[model samples]
Target chain A: MSFREKIHWVTLVTMILAFGWYFLVYPWRIVASPAGVMATAGMLVPVTIAIIVAMTVATAFLAIRSPREVHAREDERDRNIHMRGTHFGYYPLVVGIWINIFLIFWGIGQAEQLNLMIATLVVAEIVRIGTQLYLYRRGY
Target chain B: MAKPPFTNDIRTLRFLAGEMTQGDLGDRVGVTRQTIAAIEQGKYSPSLEVAFRIARVFGKPLEAVFQWDDAGD
Candidate 1:
């Protein structure tokens, strides 16, 4: 695999594991309460930190392992794949925003709105990265 | 996915040119080795500039490297 493809794999797995833990252990019972918002905020700190640290470490290790590929510039194929991935990701983002807007009109709890937004972002990111990975694997 | 509508003779050209590695051609053509491989396999269609670059790398005309597949049409 190319260096970029390996990095994408690492990112996909990391996001899956980190967010999987976040949703699995989240206090869903309190999702309608104010404390639920605080919990979301509190938990986000660690999740963000973990993603950053993991990406940093993984990128460093990969760069070290393949010093030559580390300096390789993004080519046309990479750019094309990225643009297509972003195009796919945009759909989920727009749908999520529309849903959030409707929920606001329905007076959904603040924590619920927050959680919905978070889920939307996670889904969009997954779709984006997944699309890119698929294109890469497909040799596009 | 469907194959590209055209094909290339990159593999044969590379062999004729002392068995040039895809990485070497990519470097000279300003692309990744995988892009060259994808072009060779007809899994991807390169931009006109890149196509010309590949042709130049092999010291051939563009049509010499790539040809349209009329059967696909």
Candidate 2:
């Protein structure tokens, strides 16, 4: 595969893994007792750190495995794909962020309500990367 | 920026230049390799300056490297 495609694959996989780790910890909160919830939340930080470390290591391996292609500059098709994909996702990003800010303004209540901002950014990134992968596969 | 109604023979040029690499040419032309490939694919048109630079690398006139095509329906 092309370097662009490889980079896309690496990024997509890493993002998904991060999301997977997040869901594993956050969505299972009900299973835990009060102390368990605190313990789980505390464990989340380290799990997140581990996920990041894994992603970094995997990316490094992929990059090393194909230095020529990975380091090669992107070509027209890649740029076009990226441009079209970024523009496609930009609208959703703006809208998602605006809604998130509105949620904040409405005082969504929880101290962690502000955490929605991070979710918004994450979702936008996911959308952007997904769109890029789709466009690359579909062509510009 | 808008992509102009233009096309190029970069693929053919690449063949003729003793199989010059897209990356090497991109380095010389001051663009990302992806941009070069996009231009060659007719998906994205480059700036006039870039177009001229590309033409210069092949020692051809700008028109020789690129031209307009109205075949799009």
Best TM-score among the predictions, by candidate number: 1
RMSD of 2: 4.3
| Reference A-B contact fraction recovered by candidate 2 | 0.18
lDDT of 2 by residue, B1-73 (tens): 3455777888889789989888788889977666677678765667778888999999999889998778742
Model 1, B52: alpha-carbon shift in Å?
0.5
How would you encode candidate 2's per-residue C-alpha lDDT over A17-127 as one tens digit per residue? 776666555744443344544554565677578767876787788878877666566655566677777787687778877887787787553424434554566677778
* Top candidate, metric DockQ: 1
List runs of model 2 lying over 4 Å from the truth.
A24-44, A69-94, A97-107, A111-115, A135-140, B1-4
Report the C-alpha displacement of residue A118, candidate 1, in angstroms.
0.7
Interface RMSD of candidate number 2: 5.2
Q: What class would a CAPRI assessor give candidate 2's docking?
A: acceptable
What does the lDDT read for residue A46 in candidate 2? 73
TM-score of each: 0.98, 0.72
